[model samples]
Target: MNKRSLRTTLIAIGIPTVYAVVLRLLFGIESWANLFSVMTVTFLFCLPTIVGALTVYLSDASKARKTSYRIIAPWIPVFLFFVITLALALEGWACWLMILPVFLIAASLGGLLGGYLKARNMNNKLSISTLVLLPLLLSPLESMIESLPGTYKAYTYIDIDAPADKIWRNVTRVMEIPEAEDTGYLTRTLGFPRPVKAELNYEGVGAYRKAIFTNGLVFHETVTEYQDLQKMVFNIKAHPHEIPSTTLDEHVVIGGDYFDVLSGTYELEKLPNGIHRLHLYSYFKMNTTFNFYAGLWGKWIMKDIQNNILKIEKQRSESM
Candidate 1:
């Protein structure tokens, strides 16, 4: 690549990288899973196209628009992958592998659009207009997405050297976990409430239960399915203002309009000889353009919480 071409490439990559760093590191933006971040992703998608077209416009004015597309098409993914790695490392985010495909697809579409605009000699006008209006367009899109319906699940299991009956007691009601026992740094850092103790108010279907989390957040659940010593399920009740934002930014709450935990399950299965298997499951949904990306962090956070509870249960069950 010529010096000018190389300069265009570096500037295109650097601009987005700096924006991301500011959003995530300085401003404490949690994840690329939010609608605002998705808007940023859309910006990144269109950025390379503009850069490519501008390169042609400046350097080779008569170059075919297809040539610009061809030169920049492959670099879109390369540049994005670099940004993803940098973000993941700096922010300790999740699911880069899965989010990569979404980024690639968005970049491809944006690059094609940019190429078409360049072909029609409208690249500059369109690029400028899009940059100005994208944030505005994304606001309503985020709202619409937040209102859509989606349900997802995460599962975690452990084998205990004890009987099913022994494990059931701990599963039904987790005792007061000591504050030290709660390894909450992960959730706390992300502004998610830490898991505390859970209390069950009666037995059988329609029974009431409360799962108390840190930050004064509690989940109210109604027993939907109950079986003695084998399985238990609870349908989550709508709990308003349950998710708190521990960050300076007010827009990153994982609960409320952005995401919700719908239900949860705990099960114990009898295994061969002197052992039992315990399973924990959580069902949730996120209303965001980047649901796929958001789901990754959701699963990790849920899985860690599940493992914490199961570890306590395993220790208690074996000793009993």
Candidate 2:
């Protein structure tokens, strides 16, 4: 808690905190459930800079620069702990990503310490190295965490009584759909934002349609390929977060905001006693900002579609 140590603590804590506050004030806006607000606050509160700074200040760097492996050689346990925690928590190989970068940082920082200690022939200098190592590593790591964009999801299904052939007839007929009323307003399937509208000549591939929203959220969904009852594949413009740049080229539609395509099959299967299954898969990404709270809004909206189909199509099941 001496002058140098206190100064180190303030610098580590202050810089990250000030940046967090400024960013939040300038650009961070809270959505439905205040998910970003809470996450942003929590992230800033745990800024690791202070911890790394203290480690550096306490070490006797006078001899710190001389030592070849002064801190890292002994701190293998600490490195292993973070690595293990990351691996266990993150899905797939994402966890291990943090480890190598941190290790490289340690090697360079601790290597510098190693060189210093070797030159001066100094003894143990634990404090300074510990502080310097993590900041050199953790700051970049933390920034990456903050920048990752959230993901969204949605699902909808419809059952038809007539043969699978009849169902396929109606599925691809975009113009044939009923004007989405108070309820049928399914995903991007309905109202379709602003100047953008479904192209009337959209008989097949290469069809480009746009949906514009007032809040600067426009998305474009393009039809890549189309075939009879087999499959329909489409590509959406990348999510705002998919790239380093923030402002998307234009807010045409809710491609990622809502799903891009509604795909299904014209096949038969067993649903119940003497009943055939006309199974279908609606492909689309939910158009909504995800946060810890407020749950999944798009999914809830889609649940209505499932209920609608079951309600509208229920009479056919009973009649059979």
Candidate 3:
């Protein structure tokens, strides 16, 4: 590539980094990491890349240099992703890394879209208009995205070598989960509570149980359906302050204002032999502008929690 093209690429790459710093300064570090915040930041980053690619093609650069520039365009935003994430981490904002993939994907896609539009000989006036209207468009688009109703479920099942009856006994009231039994990379990093134990006050429908977690977070579970060894349904009642956060924003916690652990169920199906299929299901709510992305992380974290509990129950029943 020619020196001119190289300079353009470097400037394009630096745009997103500078944008991120300015965003942090404007919104503060904590507010800069939400779904809307990340999306807006990514959109702003894409504008420069789009404008940069257009500038390269419209400039006095040679045909070969233009071709080379288009080829390397996508990486500009990706490079920005790494640089911006590193900056956030250095500032003690590593929690933003959880959505690193989102930012990277957004950058890459935006760069490609920008290049595609430029290649179509789209009027520069239209491109400039898009940049002007894009921010205005995002506010309502985000609301529409968040307003879209969604009921998401996470299912995890394990085949235990124990009888359904034994598994039921263990499932109804899980014993103390030792600290060693609670080692999950994501959960540990997010500071999610580990289940200590569970207690039931009654036996049939309308019964109440409390599953305690680390850091004083407690879930009040009220049984809705009771079918012995077959199905158990319960609703989740939780308080936010009891949960901890890895960031200054407590909204990252599951029970926070924007996210919730709605309800859960456990089902046991006796197989042809002595084994049982223990199914753990969770239904959650995400009242956020980025439910799609939030739901992804929510399912992962819940799946980890479910598997941990099931693993212990499986071990306990097998040992019995």
Candidate 4:
């Protein structure tokens, strides 16, 4: 590459990356200056847009004219920012995985805007400066707005060629699950702890149960309603303090400040074909300014965990 192109590449990639790292470090501090937060709309949405705009604005005008270049070039630096944060432990893999889609899209939009300004030969310097400083100015205001907690449900089911009684037995007290038996695609892909086993002392209302997972994560459950071989309802609680810090990212930790699982239910329905359909569902809460997006991931993760357990229950019940 020529010196001018190389310079454009470095400026496009370096400036945004440095800005992201600075913001990340600033957000990590705990004090009155808490406006720079990682969980806010500014960080998740605006920062990436600035990164993209800067990439296009700083690029050589000739190269920026290509429609494909405008869209894809910004992603390189955003991806580079992702790698740097993960490598430095500034952010966790799970958190990055969740925000990656948003970052890429916002960056592309920023690039398009940059391309437009370049084509018009607008006052690019002033515009780029404003965009670069936008997050810093907006985050404090965004943080001032209180995050409202929202409750959501993730429901899943599986059909088993077994009697209700057989399914109930497995549902009430799950045996130790072998690693090979786990099939939670999303959870496993995101590095979430896998289900290990669950133990219930008895089968009735007010019964105590413990659901164990890998990496020392545990869910304490108390039966609230019960119908023999038909339905079971339990309140689920996971103490963030009890869970190892390495098990989950703090931003998405179960029972943490931002997200939690509230309860779970299991119902068995006998179809006329003499098959039992086991229904599993869980209620989860998310307290974030961006619940509209975070809730989607929350539901997906809960369903994956529930479906994993349901699959194991189906196999075990059918084998009986």
How close to the true structure is residue 191 of candidate 2, measured as C-alpha lDDT?
27
By the TM-score metric, which is better: model 2 or model 3? Answer: 3
TM-score of each: 0.61, 0.34, 0.72, 0.97
Q: Could you tell which candidate, 1 or 2, scores higher by TM-score? A: 1
- Which residue pairs in candidate 4 collide? none
Candidate 1 per-residue lDDT, tens place, 158-250, comes to 999987777887888778878676665555555455667889987689888888877767878888999988889998754555444432123
Clashes of each: 0, 30, 0, 0
Model 2: lDDT to the true structure: 0.37
Q: Which number leads on lDDT?
A: 4
lDDT of 3 at 106: 51
Question: Would you list the rank order by TM-score, best first?
Answer: 4, 3, 1, 2
Tell me the tens digit of each residue's lDDT in model 4 across 5-24: 89878987888788877878
Q: After superposition, how far is residue 134 of candidate 4 from its true place, in Å?
A: 0.8
Rank by lDDT, highest first: 4, 3, 1, 2
| Better structure of 3 and 4 per TM-score | 4
TM-score, model 1 to reference: 0.61
The total of clashing pairs for model 3 equals 0
Candidate 1 positional error at 166, Å: 2.7
List clashing residue pairs in candidate 3: none
Cα misplacement distance, residue 155 of candidate 1 (Å)? 1.4
- Local distance difference test, per candidate? 0.61, 0.37, 0.66, 0.90
